[model samples]
Target chain A: MLTAIAIVIIGVLLFLANMFMDNYQLRILNLSGIYIILSLSMILINGFLGLFSLGHAGFMAIGAYTVALLTTPPMAKQMNYYLDPIVPWLAETEWSFLPAILLGGVLAAIAGFLIGAPVLRLRDDYLAIATLGFAEIIRIVFTNLQSVTNGSLGLKGLPEIEIEIPLPLIGFTLNLSACIWIAAIITILFMVRLVNGSYGKAFKAIREDEIAAEAMGINVFKHKLLAFVIASFFAGVGGAFLGNIMGTVDPLMFRFLLTYNIVLIVVFGGIGSLTGGVLAAIVITAAMELLRFLDSSFDMGPIAVSGIPGLRMVVFSLLLMFIIIFKPRGIMGVREFSWQWLIELPQSIKNSSFGRKKLRKDVSK
Target chain B: MSLLRTENMTMRFGGVVAVSDLNVHLDKNEIIGLIGPNGAGKTTAFNMISGVYKPTVGKIILGKEEVQGGQTVTVEKDITGMKPSAITKLGIARTFQNIRLFKELSVLENVVIANHLRLESNWVSSVVRTPDYTKKETAMYDKSMALLEKVGLAELKDEKSYSLPYGMQRRLEIARALATKPHILLLDEPAAGMNPQESDELMRFIGKIRDEFDLSILMIEHHMQLVMGICERIYVLDYGITIAEGNPYEIQNNPKVIEAYLGVDD
Candidate 1:
């Protein structure tokens, strides 16, 4: 019943936002939705599996490029592929948004599997560095793949994804925002289901102690690979959404900075918490957009404050430092949103004074 | 055939011999002990048998199964260099001296993870939460809780494993090993840090699990009281070589054992 209420509320809010909100606000919302998917993916590898991976942006780029190329109109493909025409087969095949997004995710998942097979053996900083290298390799490949990706010129005039489904007795039009919201909700739900299950328990076991996990017959390597591949799949889907919303794609857009921004969000939300990932993704993305003023020049009456290039990043780093220094566990730590917590909150707070006294008595016993 | 057998087992680290040409065997439904002084290669021998260290040269036979005369029988096969999980699947389970429980997981989760080897639900079913998946999980949960109860940890099943007291953590380790349903239990100094009272309790616990779980046991221990009290046969090692092997009385009285435990003239 609570889930039903939540879904209905989300659906109502989505419809209202689509009808009332301007395109700029709607675009930001869409981007945040995509980030929710990506960050959830990152948390799986980095948080649950305790593997330091820096390849999400690479996966996203693969996903976005796959969607961009597949869904681009044949005319746009002809215009963009001036340097070297896109391969005959790919240029000719114009796929719908759904299959195109799935293709993007599948391709990214394949890349993740290939990369994870070799580097999943590495742990800690080494794995981070290897994944970072893979991201760089993917970037370079996109830059040089003129025929497929249109090289540095990038691709524009990407098609918008439009799909509408009707529900009987509940007349509603599901637009792009609705689609994004639906995907985000599904991704969050899927992640929650996974992280709360036996398989998720196995991942946490491996994270806590690889040797112990292996001794318990969890197959540590296989679990790590599973996380890497699944996370990649979601990251890819998120990327496809990003391309459709932005209406452009470029290799430069998926630099290490993109992955680093996601890392900041993951850490900000707390590792091993799916709710944290979703919440932090939206908050961080909104803050990034709102903090655009820091990068722009402004005047305080007679005093002119000249804008600094990359000032946004400086502020971001400062925020990250503050969170790490003060609340190192991030907003949620490893704790999830539980109904029991809600029921117990008031009672616990009221018990604080007497609870302190009673705790000492129990411990002394 | 013996439940476990090692023939001419040796382990070399660089130029140093950690364990050298040690031959030993344990029959079904028997308890055996490996004891030695500090740096006596006792743990190294355990490591070899448990597949933590591949032997430099040896035959380590983990029991295989066969049916004989309408009854099941365990036959020995050379499992010299198998992965630890593979060895675990073959019904050999072990606990480390370090008490390497999944500390962040709840006590019940630790046991359930060990039970994962027996999980028949595939990824698709687990994701979809099909009746098969949910049923298996429910069974696993009940089974894990029962194991916790037997270990006297049912009340603390929801607690983080690391937050448990030291003795309870030690018991949790043993419970985790038993969860795998191994044919043989290899405990590497399970009683290492336990006090005399705790070690005594551990001895009873060991015997109880042996009978209850139908296990053949091989453990490395420095606790002489526990070793002499419970072990049917004991092997003594000194500097990677077996110095003595006999019944408890013979090992206790052996002059070489005394020399190794005490000290010989340089």
Candidate 2:
């Protein structure tokens, strides 16, 4: 009941914000929502199934290209397909944004099934690096399919996702934030349901011990495959959303670094947790954008650092290293945020405050 | 009628034979023991029977079931070399020589996941949490708690498997196997790290599990007291061949059994 109430509150706040917030703020919001969706998918594969797959970028590429191919206007297709005409059927075809996006997810799922069948046979670091190879394979395939994907020139001018809402005497228009936020919420709810189910337990069992899980009558390979395919499906969805939000996509975007962004999110969250992933995605995305000053010639009154092209990356890397060394398990560490946790806050605060008072008294004496 | 029978089953690793020409029979409600010293073929035989390995020669007869249209499915023609999960679905469950509980999961989760082998719902229904699905999950939850109670781990259902005391962890593993509702339970050294007192407790626990679950039992043990105390039938193995097979008293007195396995010190 509280969860339902909290969701409603969030929805109302977002609805109100749609009326007041500027496009710039909304774009960052949309970007964070996309990050949340991508990270949730990462949690399913890496956290629950313990697969440590790095194929998100490749799967996203499949999805983005799918949406791009299906939804790009006829004129845009002609312009982008300068080298070789877009495949005859594709050149003439067009689809609405939502259906095209979902189809993109479906195509990515098919890719996952194909890749997972062969690669899940590997284990540990081999599986991790092998899945990264699958992602590269996706990019390479998209690049070479000149007639189908318009080679490396990429696609642009994706149709904006728009919806109108009318109140009693007022009306508002939905923008990218609407789509991204709605998608993130849907992804979160789906993941929460999945991780609390029998299949989720089965995935965890496979993670815990493949041999023991098999001996217990759980088909380890089947569960692992389920995680892979489902995670890839949502990864494709996230990719489509991101491409639409950015209004452009190229093969270059789906590189190893694209996957590394999600890897950082999952690690900054905790392994085997959903809420941690969502929260970490939001915090990490916002922090990355906020820290943009580090890349430019900005200086504090007390400290000056300027014109070092790679300095921001160095600082961020050090911060991440610090977190890893000190905390080790990352934030939230295998636990999740819950409504009941609200009850524990007062007690924890009281305990800390009581300890502080005692310390202060001892120091004064 | 035999609940399980292996006929001249053989397994070889490259050129070396691990379990050669092994024959064993188990009837319902009987406790059987497989005993051998270090490097002997006891575990290998268990591996073959439990579908961890496809026997190089011979057959593992797991079940005899009448199919639709009155066809009979026998192990000679089927069920051998199947996936371990399929073998487990054939009403066979096993525990590891080293305790291999889902260490990160809670005790209840461990037992509940095992019972999920019998789950009829698909992933979609589980995700949707439909009425039928939640009903099945609740029933499994209650049943898991009950099984944990039987194993004396009821109060510790929410504790992680790795945090449990060693003896409790072993018992927890058995409880997990029982959740699969097996007709036969194969235990790989149920008392491996137990003290003498703990082994005595384990002997009682094993007997209790067999009687209460109505399960036939097969165990590999270097623990003689456990083997001599409970097992009705004993098969002794050495270097991939059966050295002796008989009632415990006969096997205890056999010169070959003593020479091969029983005389070894812990």
Candidate 3:
């Protein structure tokens, strides 16, 4: 019951913020929500299944291009495809944002199934390399599919997602960021339910020890494939949301760097902790935005450091290195945030200080 | 009639014959021991029976069911070369030579995972948390708790499995195997690191579980006292060859068994 109320309050706060925040701030918020979905998906594959998959950018590209192709207006399609002219059927076709987004996820899942069948068999570093290769292959494929993806020129003028609250007294409108937030919340809830189930245990079992999990009657390959496909589906959904929010997409947008950013979120969060991932996603996205000034020329009181083209990324890389050295398990480790922890916090604090003082007094006695 | 029988089971790893022409039979509720020195292929036999390694040449049959015509028949399925999980589903559960509990998981989770094989609900119902899935999960939870209690680990059900004491970790692994609801239990070196006194306690514990769970057990143990104390029959292997198969007394008096353990008389 407490959780239900907390969710409602958070939901209301986000809705209110949507109404008040400027467009740029809302864009960053939407981007954070997208990152939350992406990071959660990465956690499923990399953390839970113990598969170090680096092909998320590929899946996201599939999703983004799928949504772009399906939802872009015919006029925009004509303009984007001026050199190559999109396939005749795609040029005439259009779909609403929801179905297009879901289709994107479905296509990505299908791709996951096909790719996972071959590569999920590989272990550890080999799997990572294979998946990374697949991502590059996907990006290259999208680049060359001139009639389908409009070559490197990319797809532009995609529709924005806007929803109006259907209430009698207050008809409030939700823009793209609010829609993305809703999607992220749905993703979070879905993931929480999934990880709490027996399948989740099985995934963890696989992660802990694949041989033992198989001995205990879990079909390891099947479960690994299941996790991979599900992660790919969500990656696709996040990608669709990203394209919709940006109002355009290109093959270049879905690069290895895109996947690396998602990985950064997953690592900064505790790998197996959903709450940690969600919190890290928002914090990291906001931090990245806040640190944007670092990328530009700034006078640091006494010394003026000329703007380094990728100074923001350098700072993040240093932060990641620090995290790896000092806190290998990240913020929360494998443990999740719970109400029980909150309830025990005060008592634990008292025990720490008071118990120490009492011990000192006893020693004096 | 034997509950499980192996026919001419042989496993050769390239140039080395790990277990050669081995035949074993396990009856219902029988406790058998596979005792051998290091590298003697005792674990190889267990691996074959548990479907971890497929015999290069062999047939492993399980279950002797009485058909409608009053004819006794072996289950007719040769489980050789089957996947480990499928064999586990067919009512064969085994513990590792070293304790292989899901160490990071809670004690209850370690047991509950074994029950996953019998779960009727799939991932779809799990996502939506349908009533059927919830009911199954509740039942699994209750069953796992009961199993933990029977194994004397109920109080520590919420503790991480690796946090348990060494002896308790062994017991928890047994509890995990038992949760699979297997008719036959294969234990690999259950008494490996225990002292004499602890092994004695483990002997009694093993006998108690055998009767309580109505299981046929095949164990690979380096500890003779526990094996001789509990096992009804023993098979001794040396260098992938069966040297002796008999009751404890017959094996104690056998010269071949002695030579296998002690080197052939100077």
Candidate 4:
């Protein structure tokens, strides 16, 4: 019940924020929402199922390209696919954002199932390397599939989705930012429901001990595949949202660095904690934006200096290092931020630090 | 006839024969012991029977066995090469020698996860929490709680399984196996680390559960006291071959059993 109330409150706040925030702020908000979806989905596989997957970027590329191709106008496709005309069927057809995004997610899920079928059987580092290799293969495939993905030139001028709901009072346009957050909220609710259910327990069971889990009648491979496919589905959707938000996408955009960033978020948050994932996603996304200045080249007196290409990631790497050193279990460990925890937060904070300080002061006196 | 029978089951790991042509039968509600020294292929046999290792040769059959009629064991399912989970669904459940409880999970959750084998609702229904799923979940919760109560871990249902004392952890593992509602239960060294007093309690606990759950138990234990006290029949293996199979008294008096255990009288 508290969860539902909190979600509603967050929805209302996002709605208000949608109306009030400027374009630049709203872009960050949308990016944060996209990160939330990506990190939470990654958590389902890497954290919950104990499968170390580094192929999220590949799935995202599939989604972004699918959404881009399906939603772009026929004239736009003709202009975009100049070197090699898009396949006739794709060039002529256009779809609304919802169907395109759903198709993107479904395609990505299918890809996930195919890759996971063989790769999920491998454990730990082998799984990670295989998945990372698969992602690279996907990116390279997109690069070479000239007629389909417009080769390395990439896709641009993708339409922003604006959903309008007619209410009794007035009709409000659900802009791209609003759509991203709405998608994120739905993704979160789905993840929460899944993690709290029997299937979630089974996933965790696999994480705990694959051999025991199989002995207890969980088809370990099946559960691992299920988690991988579902995570890929949401990652695909997140990718679609990101592409629409940026209004452009290329093969270069979906790289191992993308997967690395999301993995960092999942790690910085507690791996198995959904609330921690959410907190880390937002904090990391905002922090990355805040640290953008570090990457920006400033005008020196005489010499011209180009910005450092990936300074934000370096800063984030340091931040993650500090997190690993200080709070090895990440922010929340495996514990969630529940309403009961919220109620006790003040007491806990006092007892852990302030109360200890007071006792030390008294002893000193 | 037996509830479960292994016919010429053998497992050869490349050059080494781990278990050679091992034939064993378990009757309904019978307590059978597989006893051997360390590395005597007892666990290897358990592994083959529980579908962890597919036997290099022979069949494992599960079906009805009329104790009084002396009929042939009916060939219901030849689960020789099935996956462990599928074998479990066919009513075989097991506990690890090392107490492989889902350690980070709660005691109740450890048991509830076993119930997942028999879940009727799919992930979609469970996630949506439809009426059917909720009813199933509630029933699963109740069943898990009842099992915890039976094992005396009801109070610690919310505590992490790893936090429980050693004896309680063993009991929780048995409770978890019981939650799967298996007809055949394989316990791998249930009394491994227990003190004599605790093993005594475990003996009674094992007997009580066999009667209560209508289960045939196959256990591997080095604790001879517990084995002798509880097991109606015992199989002794040495170097991957069965050295003796008889009633505990008969096995105790067997020259071959003594030779194997005492090194052929020097």
Candidate 5:
């Protein structure tokens, strides 16, 4: 019941913010939603399944390019020389935002299935290296595909998605930000339902022991492939949102840094916890924005210190190192946020008043 | 009729012949004991029957399959070269000598996963978590719990498998193998590290399960007392070849068996 109340409150706040906030704040919120989706995708593979895949950015590239090619207007095809006559039917077809995004996800899933077939056979550091090589290969393919991806020049002038809802008191207005936020919330809810299911249990089992899982008739390879495909599908959708939001698609945009950033976010949030992933995405996204303020000089009473140009990254790296040494499992460990925590919250509050009694009980126990 | 029969099975790892011309047969509703000193190829024979290692030369027939023609039959249906998973689906299941339970998962989850092979639900049903899948999952949980209870591990159902006491871990391993509902079960040194009391209890537990599940068990044990107590028929191996096979009375009095155990009696 408390969870329901919290959901309702959060929904109301999002709706109000969408209605009242300026375009700049709305854009930041949309970025947060995108990060949430990407982080959840990472959690599915790395956290639950214990597969070290550094090729998420490769899947995202496939998604971004797919969306870009399918959704580009016929008139603008001439301007984008890289847009070939391949899949001409889709180019001529006009799909709404949702189906196009879903198609992008499906394409990415296919890519994941193909890659996971052979690579999932490798173990530990070997799997990591294989996935990293796959990502590098994907980047190179995009860069060299002059006819389809426009080479390094990139694609531009794609149509922006506009979401509008008719309200009784107010006039109908464009609300793309609301749509992105809604997609993010839906993704989170879907993942929560999935990870709580039997398939999720199988994935965790394979992670713990592949040989034992197989003896138990798990079809270990099949479960691992499922995890990879599902994770890649979400990554593709997130990539499509990013491409549409930025109004451009370039091979150069998907660098190794993008994959590294998402991996860092997943590790910082705690693996295998969807709630932790979402929370980490929000915190990291906001922190990156806030660090921009440090660019200007600040004066103290007796001294002044300007923000060093590359100091932010150094500080961030240090924070990662510190977290690994102190809390290797991250902030939440493998636990999700449950209603049990809320139930215990009031008890903790009451215990503060009778602290001595609580202490005595603890010692006795 | 024998449920599993391996004729002239031989496995060679490069220059080292681990098991040579090993002939073994397992009848239905029987417990067979495999005893040997270290490096006597007891595990190698088990591995060959379980399809972990393809025998260099042999015929392994499961469920009355025939052996036609010469020593080498070229039929594609040979069970000797099949994968371990395929062999398991053919009513053969084994526990590792080292206790390879899925350590991070709970004991219940581990056993339930083993029960998944018999489930009628397909991949689509599992992904959507359909009502049918949920029902099957519930049934599997109940059955797995029952097995755990039978093995005296009902209290550790929710604990991570690796966190259980060593004796409980062995019991859980057997419970997991039984979850596969195999016609024949292979236990690799189930009493490896148990105390005498635990070993005695394990002997009784093995007998009870054999009767209850109607299973054919092939176990490798170094503990002679446990072997003598539980096994209906025993096979003693020396250097990859069976030296003696008979009832407990015959085995205890055989000169060759006595020599094998007592180092030739000087």
Candidate 6:
């Protein structure tokens, strides 16, 4: 009940902010939300499941391309100039934004299934190398798929989707930023539900000890595949949103750097904790943006360390190294934020309920 | 009829024959002791029975079902070579000679994972954290806690299994094996490093759980006092073969048993 009230309160606040917040701030919010989804997906595969998959960006590429191919208007001659010829059927058909995004996710999931089958059999470090190889393979394929993906030239001129909220009292319009926030919340809730579920426990069991998990009758490979596929699906969706928000898709955008960034987010958040992942994603994303101001030389009275171009990267790397050395498990370790932490409200409610139950039993006696 | 029976079970590691021509039968609800010197192949036999190693040649029968854990064997009905997980699902659970608890996981989590074999929740239901999944999870926790209580490690339920003391670690291993709800429990050197007091306590504890759980236990123990105190029947092995099999007292007095434990006199 408190959660419901909190959600309502947050929703009202967001609505008010939506009315007054500048377009640039809203866009930043949307970008943060997309990063959260990507980070959460990373946590699912690497953090909770104990699979080091460095091919998340590959899945994202697949989703972004799929969405671009389906949603881009083929009839517009200007938009088609830099693009390669689309297959006749896809060119003729018109798909909505949501379904196109979902289709991209499905394609990514299929790709994940194919890669996970043989690769998940390998242990730890080998698994990491195999997944890294897979990402490289996907990136190379995407870069060379000149006929379908337009090779390195990339896809352009996507439809700008403007979502509208039909609210009572004060009606509001939702743009791309709003959609990203909605998607992020949905991803967060989906992950929370998943980790709290049986499959999540199975994944954690595999993480704890694969041999023991297998001995206990868990088909280790099957559970790992499930986590891999699900994580890829969400990553693909996040990728589609990212491409749409950027208004273009490029093979170069989905690179090893992106995969590494997601890894850093998950690690910074604390492995195996969804709440930690989100918190870390937001903090990291905002920090990176905030640090951009460092590019302008600060005149601190005497010493001016002229706007160092690579300063942000250096500082970020140092922070990561520090965190790893001091607290390798990350912020929350393997623990999630449970409602049990909110003690006062639940305790009061339980006490009143118990008192009422006792009175009822006495009256009956 | 014997609940579990192994006929001429043999295991070879390349040139070395670890266990050879070993025949053993375990009746339901019986405590059987397997004793041998350091390299006596007692654990080798346990490994074969528990599906850790496939016997090079042997027939293993669990209840009415006969399956091979070591190597491919031609059976009357089919060619059967079951995997360790499959064998475990066939109602055999085991612990390692060296404690092999999932070190990073909590004690409760360890038991919960073991109980996963019997969980009926499908992947979809589990991923959704549905009411059914929660119910099953709660039941699993309750069952695991009960098992922990039986093994006197209920206080360490939230502690990491590896962090427990050596004696408590051994008990936790038993608790974890029991969590699998196996019909037959295999303990590989359950009291390997324990002092006299701890070993005696473990022996008593094993007996209490055997009767309470109505489980058939096959234990590999070097501690003669502990083994002889509880085991109804004991099998003595030497140089990769079973040399003596009888009641604990009978086996204790056997010439071959003395030869195996202490070198034979000229």
Clashes of each: 0, 0, 0, 0, 0, 4
Give chain B TM-scores in order.
0.97, 0.93, 0.96, 0.95, 0.91, 0.91
Question: Model 4 — interface RMS deviation?
Answer: 0.6
With candidate 2 superimposed using the best TM-score fit, by how many Å does residue B111's alpha carbon deviate from the native?
A: 0.4
- Lowest-sum lDDT 10-residue window in model 6 chain A: A76-85
Q: Name the best candidate (by lDDT).
A: 4
Cα lDDT of model 4 by residue, B205-252, tens digit: 999999999999999999999999999999999998999999999999
Cα lDDT of model 5 by residue, B151-234, tens digit? 778888899888999998898989889989987899999999999999999999999988999899999998889999989899
Model 6 per-residue lDDT tens digits across residues B128-207: 66788788988988898888887778888899778899998888878887888788899888998999999988988988
Q: Write the per-residue lDDT of candidate 3 for residues B71-181, one digit (tens) a residue.
A: 766565689989999999988999998889898999999999999999988898999999989999999999999998888999999999999999999999999989989
**lDDT tens digits, residues A1-365, model 1?**
67667889988887888889999888888889988998999999999999999988899999999999988889989988888989888888788777788889999999999999999999999999999999889989999988889988889998787654557887665567877888899888788878778888889988999888888777889989998999999999998888778888998988999899899999999988888888999999999999898799988789998998789999999999999999898999999877678779988975898887887899999
**lDDT by residue for model 4 (A151-190), tens:** 8999988888776686878977877877888899898889
Off by over 4 Å in 2: A163-174, A300-304, A351-365, B64-77, B262-266
Docking quality class, candidate 2: high
Complex DockQ, candidate 5: 0.50
Error of 3 at B73 (Å): 6.2
Runs of candidate 5 with Cα error greater than 4 angstroms are A1-8, A80-94, A162-175, A294-307, A348-365, B64-78
Docking class of 1: medium
Ranking by lDDT: 4, 3, 1, 2, 5, 6
Would you list the C-alpha lDDT of every candidate in the order shown? 0.89, 0.87, 0.90, 0.91, 0.83, 0.82
By the lDDT metric, which is better: model 2 or model 4?
4
Residues A231-306, model 5: lDDT tens digits: 9999998988888888899988898888887987898899878899999888887777777555667665678877
- Candidate 2 lDDT score at position A144: 88
